[model samples]
Target: MIAASDLPEVIPLFPLPGALLLPRARLPLHVFEPRYLAMFDDVLKTPQRLIGMIQPQDGEDEGLAAIGCAGRVTGFSETGDGRYMITLSGISRFRLGERVEGFAPYIRAKVAWEDFARDLGAPEQDAEFRREPFLRLLERYFEARDLSTDWASLREAEDERLINSLSMLLPFDVSDKQALLEAPGLPERREILAALMEFALHAGDEGSEILQ
Candidate 1:
């Protein structure tokens, strides 16, 4: 429920590869690294309690991707072993800006929020989504990879929820997931998602234990 004016210009960043957080989706994370644990401590003090979830770009020395999503800390608990378990509910996507230089331990970045203003407005609906076909593809994709899922839950989810959740949870390539995250809208994202699954199924590696 954070207003656009309340969103901070600069926030703590977590540069994990292959992780994507789309608007309104929830991502759960386990914080064990000392620096991130410290980050959570500092972040909890802020009113927004937001963190930037970005992926490190591909290659040995590439920097962060151009876009990332900001998520608010919704659920938090501390483990006896000193690790922190937290859930981030995605708020909006932001365009990456310059990294703030200092001794804050974890990375912090200046982000611009204008391009993705739609993220904060309301949940989206994709009228073009055909559930039966998409679910058929998903079932084949899951079965091909020996993956198991709750069919009932998927059938019960809304279009945006199902597509966005799959985009985040799927084992697509980092680049592919990034494409899904960067998709201009839900319909476009759904297209990319379906294409990716179709490609994977026909990629001649159906027997592979895990998605590549």
Candidate 2:
């Protein structure tokens, strides 16, 4: 249970395009780049083992999107060859504030948590939302891609868990992924994901190549 006050005002930002971390979800990262390796080392020495996962607007030189989710280091392992394999547990989404100079090699940003306070706890389910349509679309999408998934596990997942997990796992375009990250709530995110999946399916049927 993380309180708003417990979150830091400034956090090291990891700007990887198409990578998203919704609250309560887990994101695994492999850190090999020198700058991010430095960032990882710095975080290891801190009491707040947190990092902000954001997507760059364009290339790494370009600006970052305004919103990103904060994740706390929950698992970590280091290779002898100088690399880090870590897992982060999502905390909450944050709106980026001004960038600030920080000790780490990576960029750090001041963030506002007011817009996503609800993310600290379990998401509220929408009684009116239908899961069948979304599930059907997902099945089709997986089949089209020739991806194998555990159906029993997916069926047993909670609504929020299912939606967020799929959103992170599916290979959507960068912009589409950002849209899902910025969605106001779980239901809205689910709707946006379904729409994106449908659009991709239609594009494939029209003989247009779909981006994985």
Candidate 3:
């Protein structure tokens, strides 16, 4: 039930390479690196201890992508070793505004949730858009992963949870994960997921399954 206006208008986000935060999911990050430890320290000083988690572009560890999800500091406990053990509960995805320059160690960017659409129920388009393809893609994904799934539970799950969980659980490459984070809407995201799952399965068709 939370909306864009209820959250902080501007948030300093940590741009992490090879990681993505999808709405309604928890992204746990270990902050031992000096840069990210500094990032956590900066969060403690702010009234709104929220940080957007965005994946860095290929070959670029410092620069951020145009889109990322806003994450609230749901879990924080310092370890005796001085590293931070923290968890981020996804709120809403935001658009990256600009990079903030400072000596805080980690690169940060301003983000706004205004343009981001909160993924809730199924889109207004059609049940068919979500139903048939989603089930098919999920079935293929589980089979390919050799995972034993509870079909009954999956059948009862809503579209948002199904899509978000799959995006996180699947062994997709970093660039593909970033694409999932940037997907326009639920329907569009689901469609792209269908394509990604199919490609992953077929990528092994040359008689060489890479994941093996």
Candidate 4:
């Protein structure tokens, strides 16, 4: 476990609403918003093109969760006109140590990663309590959203792949998303995501037909 102070610090942050970056995940983001555009500029200037990806409470930026994950800029490029598109690769889980005033119109945070060493080789799979429920709920979620998911891809994904993909792409509320970010492990996160998906699916079905 690396110390928070020991982790390299990067200025400027990318705050995406209703999104969480879990460890070992790959997230692609389009940068067009002015604040994040400025963030890109700052990151382009240095080697520390890292950011703390945190989720704020629903409809409220002032109320942010204390825990977040650290993402390093893995692949980034610009079009001929200077529009920046980038991919964020999750490195480790981190907690917000303090609030930084302003780096580039976006909020900055002092962060410390979790002390425990996560063994990627072990896979950290939650076979019994998680797999089936998550898939079931995910199917229902897709139906409710009127989305046509590629089942072949979904079925082939491993635990980390499934969890990370769902965490980023799930259409849950900000608070719900934050909870997934703060969830302890694959088992817990999978369960919570299942429940949330079920809730959204049922609630939408009851109130209005999303398919219509």
Per-candidate clash tally: 0, 0, 0, 0
Model 1 CA deviation exceeding 4 Å by range: 58-62, 205-212
Residues 25-70 of candidate 3 have per-residue lDDT tens digits of: 7888888987778778888787657787877765456466788887
Which portions of model 2 miss their true places by more than 4 Å?
208-212
Name every residue pair that clashes in candidate 2: none
- 131-171 in candidate 1: lDDT tens per residue? 99999999999987789999999999998899999999999
Poorest stretch of ten by lDDT in candidate 2:
203-212
lDDT (C-alpha, whole model) for all candidates:
0.92, 0.88, 0.74, 0.71
lDDT, candidate 3, at 145:
76
- Give candidate 3's whole-model lDDT: 0.74
> Backbone clash tally for model 1?
0
- The residue pairs that clash in candidate 1, if any, are none
Q: List the residue pairs that clash in candidate 3.
A: none
Report model 3's TM-score to 2 decimal places.
0.81
Model 2 lDDT on a 0 to 1 scale: 0.88
lDDT of 2 at 24: 94
**In the order shown, what is each candidate's alpha-carbon RMSD?**
2.9, 2.6, 3.5, 3.6
Which candidate, 1 or 4, would have the higher lDDT against the true structure?
Answer: 1
